[model samples]
Target: NNPKKTGPTLNETFLGLLYPTENYKVYGYLTNTKVKFILVTTDLDVRDADVRNFFRRFHSAYVDAVSNPFHVPGKKITSRTFAERVSTIVKSFGLSTAV
Candidate 1:
């Protein structure tokens, strides 16, 4: 591996933590086209890698949802594929073995 690269490329999809609260924290990811994703969790000790993985998987689901030829632009996503993927991602949050 090239020593120059430390980790995954800073892909615009998984923007890190936005803010933290006493009981929980909120993270954000904003797409270049302005779609936004938010994740709030009570687990303050969660790792950045885990959060990144969550958003990356969620973003992939969103992308796949809108990739259909018949999908209308600007319409809300109701795809089952996206729903299932997101459900699994959310349920597996903070689990190192999830990936």
Candidate 2:
């Protein structure tokens, strides 16, 4: 009944831990600064290289977001520009924006 609880609990394990559930694959990337990026995909054939590329592009967007003069570090991202950039990047990979 609590399927949502599993993801966060597994995420606490560590960076780079790929946790596979019955219908999805959860991938993780942790920066040296401890910023966690989690990617959940239903495509079983998704390759690690593609995941790495996605994270790289996402990281670039994240950097640009944080570099803004008005941006506050460690706070939730509320920038529309950053969201649009990330959505575009994700769409380029033929992935849906729902996630």
Candidate 3:
């Protein structure tokens, strides 16, 4: 039972962890295919506009992953490209600003 291969790796594909630290919040989404997405994140002080954009980008990533011919519906997403996209989304949480 290797930790790397333990359980469905979908949890990691979301954000590299099953859950975040204390004071975090959880969000959910239901895809057209009945796929449910739940994610936890530390309380963020991001702007409303940023939050919308963030979800949009995240959803885009998920769609791309599922669209992969090798991906099996309702199964763990093992695409390295998907994981890297998630990492990038989390890293670029917020960098743009205007006044």
From the highest TM-score down, the ranking of the candidates is 1, 2, 3
TM-score of 2: 0.72
**lDDT of model number 2:** 0.76
User: Which pairs of residues clash in candidate 1, taking residues 3 or more apart in a chain or in different chains?
Assistant: none
lDDT per residue as tens, model 1, 8-94: 475657667889989999998888678999999999999988888888888888888899887898998887877888899889889
lDDT of 3 at 49: 49
**Higher-scoring candidate on TM-score, 1 or 3:** 1
On lDDT, the leading prediction is: 1
Backbone clash count, each prediction separately? 0, 0, 0
**RMSD score of candidate 2 (Å):** 10.7
lDDT for 33 in candidate 1 is 72
Model 3 Cα lDDT, one tens digit per residue, 5-24: 64434432232233445676
**lDDT, model 1:** 0.84
Clash pairs, candidate 2, are none
Q: At residue 28, what lDDT does model 1 achieve?
A: 86
